[model samples]
Target chain A: MDTQQAAGTSVLPADPGALTPAEARAAFRSGLAVPTAGWSRGFAQANLIIVPRDLAFDVLLFAQRNPKPCPVLGVLDAGETSGPLLAGGDIRTDVPRYTVYRDGQKVDEPTDIRQYWRDDLVTFIVGCSFTFESALREGGISIAHIDQNVNVPMYRTEVRCEPAGSMAGPLVVSMRPVPASQVADAVRITSRYPAVHGAPVHVGNPHELGIADLARPDFGDPVDMPEGHVPVFWACGVTPQAAVMESRPALAIGHAPGHMLITDARDSQYLVP
Target chain B: MDTQQAAGTSVLPADPGALTPAEARAAFRSGLAVPTAGWSRGFAQANLIIVPRDLAFDVLLFAQRNPKPCPVLGVLDAGETSGPLLAGGDIRTDVPRYTVYRDGQKVDEPTDIRQYWRDDLVTFIVGCSFTFESALREGGISIAHIDQNVNVPMYRTEVRCEPAGSMAGPLVVSMRPVPASQVADAVRITSRYPAVHGAPVHVGNPHELGIADLARPDFGDPVDMPEGHVPVFWACGVTPQAAVMESRPALAIGHAPGHMLITDARDSQYLVP
Candidate 1:
């Protein structure tokens, strides 16, 4: 089917249906509301951040400084509703949901942000660890969150992000339980894709990255650690979103947790090695 | 000895007699004449590009797109001569020699470029392959050009660089004859230094990269290819200089070939793994 006609159809009634990235994006644009975790398999998903033009340079610098946590996939032109470079998907309504922040407070969860879109907004799409997680799973590493059907445990660490201009915050991380024998393989696999969160930021000791407890997390549900599985921490894409909150912009927007912007771009485009 | 005093005492009659990066840069600023390669032993050497304010963004975008050949070390603001971010080195005179180009033509080679400095000029310091070359040597890979006492063989390739505005040209690659046994080791060693042209662009056959005769190079002298030694090519720093020449800006400035800018930044800063 042609892309436009395919897009005209609403989202699949259930999560089990097969949906291409383009179709999933279309469903999102049509307001077929759902989180994008399992919407488009084998396709790359991105964390979205929308900020005013004045703060674009600072935010971009921050990403550049902390690449592990914020691997920028594409930077859209100011006020551009479509990501022409990355996926040719409309940014306005292509994401199933968005959280609007006004002066550091979450004021609204909008299904479609076309009503709040402005001419001066710049969109930054950052690579999420979902791409690397797929690689790990393919390599036979089991992910506890996927097995338990829970969001990956995320934490705000004592490790401060390299501050850029007015945007500064603690480094945020996501933890995954990995078997000890497969940890080296996991590093080798993820290291090939630096544009995605790359390799694990911390492997054995969680406290080295300033996390005091694996049982307690700043965000997401903590899953039970299986026998012989060690907690591996990676720089999370949610870092920039947290920074935006602490930095307190007059206006900011981001994808709600577990809901990502599905892009037409493939996961392989991000692989370096 | 103090760095300034060391600079004054080390001014030899021939070759300026090997000074540290700081001493060498200070001497270069004070009219000392010499190539910078041998002086800064373990520090990173950079290719310098000075262009007008109008072309800065495009040139930067071009570098971003073509990172293998043109790894950007630091970019100075318009009218600025020193790069405070990279090494706090003076752009106008820290380099051993400067080549001035006007309307795509080489006008003069000067020890210092203060006379050519303009308020609208923006300076770009790009990473050079010397750091990786040093790493290869440390890993016991013998470089033929250093042994033959000639410039590394460089050729203009059929590969087209991603265009950014008016900046676009064929990529230039430097060739090294490596023994077959050391090819894997060479790749591994050089891959660790992404900031310094990274790994080999093309290995083994020169024909693969469209180079017809290995005996004759478009730039630099050809070296002896020992038996069982395969030709390895790397993305050259000259690619951006060639792009600038093609763009034909009214004024362009660069380092004379083999005459690099010695920065206080250590080569260790560029090693990724």
Candidate 2:
């Protein structure tokens, strides 16, 4: 019974506190795979992107230009498996699942991408929302997605990111409902972790951010918004994937939405302040 | 007469409290053509590198891989005049002097690079030693180069930086003589500013870093190392220029040694801790 088949039949482990990054990776490698959202507690999770060598530079430039939405944590050289500078973690078979994009379309959702991996491909592990979410939880803020057991609602905004080369797209953001009284605490907690989106791009009024409706997100499951709480929007890791898709590269690979690469790096290593 | 001719004939400003970042940039624009070592009081200065679009990504990757030597502050899109994200400052004329490199060789030193500007040129402003120097002074540590009225001693070290595509070279470092009692103070002060080559890469030994002689630097003038003072080496901005030059890009541009860009952004903005 492969991990994918097992995942289809029963609920996978939601609490990754018992597993190491390597163990979590091994489970994925063995096909006991699922989205890595809660798989490895207190460790840094990354948004993965693999592209052909030709488009690597342009994509990197786009990320640099739009740092708030695309904070790059580490990059792997073409054909390289491990980023020694980023805690010596293997790039291959690290994440549980991957989404293969061909010519701007999601073509396949595979458990392991070793078959699709190419020698000319460059890998980028960008900052993910999980890091900041952990920080916010530690600061006494309860995220509704965790409680509701749903994916955080993500939307494509009207805000245009600074373009670089052939890479240009609207900024995509993820929303979390926050109590009005705890808004200041949310900002203070997340601001300390700039590597992972760092601070909210918009705190209130989804319409102001070009998000027409809070309940109708372009991606992910929309969570309930209480009356006393306001919807806060953060620059999403999905922005890069959206940019890559719009650019229409011959081939691109990303983590299957919530599936992330768990790195050996500690979350505290990213706290800038 | 232009500012350069006037600057060569007069004693430069010594008071660190003389000018603000905005005033310094304005002065540079109005022909106060001098190396910005001490002009902008309490402001962090930056090393500028302008490269053709074809090589910008490789250079950026090189910088990211070797952050200890090339801490990037802001990167501007090709042909863009202002970096509103870093500071709303014009890059072309903000630096006091610019060095033009053709096929890895120095061609000209111009006060303004408006004539050499190209539509496909990308600009990168890297953190400079001035940020740390200011912190050291604030902590009551005296820098020998500033005291001796000479350029900081720089050496080409044997340490090979992590290579990126088309950009790989030995790490070049700048040395400052710090008193034995103040070495800790220097580290503590500089560690707070990682955006600037944070902390000393090496302390107390020049031979370990492969420098044969303290008085004879590979680049820049050597300052005296007094008794009970150790030579502290920091990863330098020169590493990127060396990497770029080694790659032999057909066209590359950089700030002249000692000369730097004065941005509207304040130094305090870069203090990480």
- Give each candidate's fraction of reference contacts reproduced: 0.00, 0.12
Q: Find the 10 residues in a row with the least total lDDT in model 1 chain A.
A: A8-17
lDDT of 1 by residue, B110-138 (tens): 98898999998878888888777777888
RMSD of each: 4.8, 4.0
Candidate 2 chain B worst ten-residue window by lDDT = B5-14
Worst 10-residue stretch by lDDT in candidate 1 chain B? Answer: B9-18
Query: Which regions of candidate 2 deviate over 4 angstroms?
Result: A1-15, A85-93, A112-118, A179-182, A226-230, B1-34, B79-120
- Model 1 chain B, TM? 0.88
Give the TM-score of chain A, superposed on the true chain A, for all candidates in the order listed. 0.90, 0.91
Please list the C-alpha lDDT of all candidates, in the order they appear.
0.79, 0.80
lDDT of 1 by residue, A1-273 (tens): 345435555534455226787767777777766555555667788888899977775676677668899987777767878854436678988887898998878898887898889999988898888777777888999878777877678899889998866789888898888889998988898888788799889998888888888898987778898899888888888898889989999999998766788877777888775
- On residues B1-273, what C-alpha lDDT tens digit does candidate 2 reach at each position? 235523543334445347666556655555455656555666778888889988887898998778888988878878887775335556776677788888888899887788899989998889888776777887899877777767677899988998888999989898998889988988888887777898889998888888899899987788988899989999888888888778889989998777787665667887864
lDDT of 1: 0.79
Positional deviation of residue B216's Cα in model 1 after best superposition, in angstroms: 7.9
